[model samples]
Target: MPQMSPLNWMSLYILFIFVFLIFNIINYFLFLYSPNQNKNFKKKILFNWKW
Candidate 1:
């Protein structure tokens, strides 16, 4: 098997880390601003009332 150079591996690792951080930040903001929490709370209240 051919081995990758250290520089090549480092660059690939950096790129993967950069992409992962960007996606995670985007998902964090989406979750932070999500409107489903209100609906979920309402559902939970109604569910508890039924039991």
Candidate 2:
């Protein structure tokens, strides 16, 4: 393996970090999971019965 200078190493690290962040962001949006929502949820009053 060729020896890399400090500047070269820094740039390589930055490049990899950016790539990792971008990949994670893409995956996060791709697999967006939402819990099942009830259509009538808004119609039901939570405080209908007061203790």
Q: Could you report the Cα RMSD, in angstroms, for every candidate shown?
A: 8.3, 5.6
Model 2, CA-based lDDT: 0.88
RMSD of 1: 8.3
lDDT of 2 by residue, 1-51 (tens): 357687799999999999999999999999999999777665645785768
Q: lDDT for every model? A: 0.80, 0.88
Poorest 10 consecutive residues by lDDT, candidate 1: 37-46
TM-score of every model? 0.53, 0.57
Q: What is the lDDT of candidate 1?
A: 0.80
Per-residue lDDT tens digits of candidate 1, residues 6-32? Answer: 878899999999999999999998779
Residue 47, candidate 1: how far off, in angstroms? 20
Per-residue lDDT for 8 in model 2? 91
RMSD of 2: 5.6
Quote the lDDT for 13 in model 1.
96
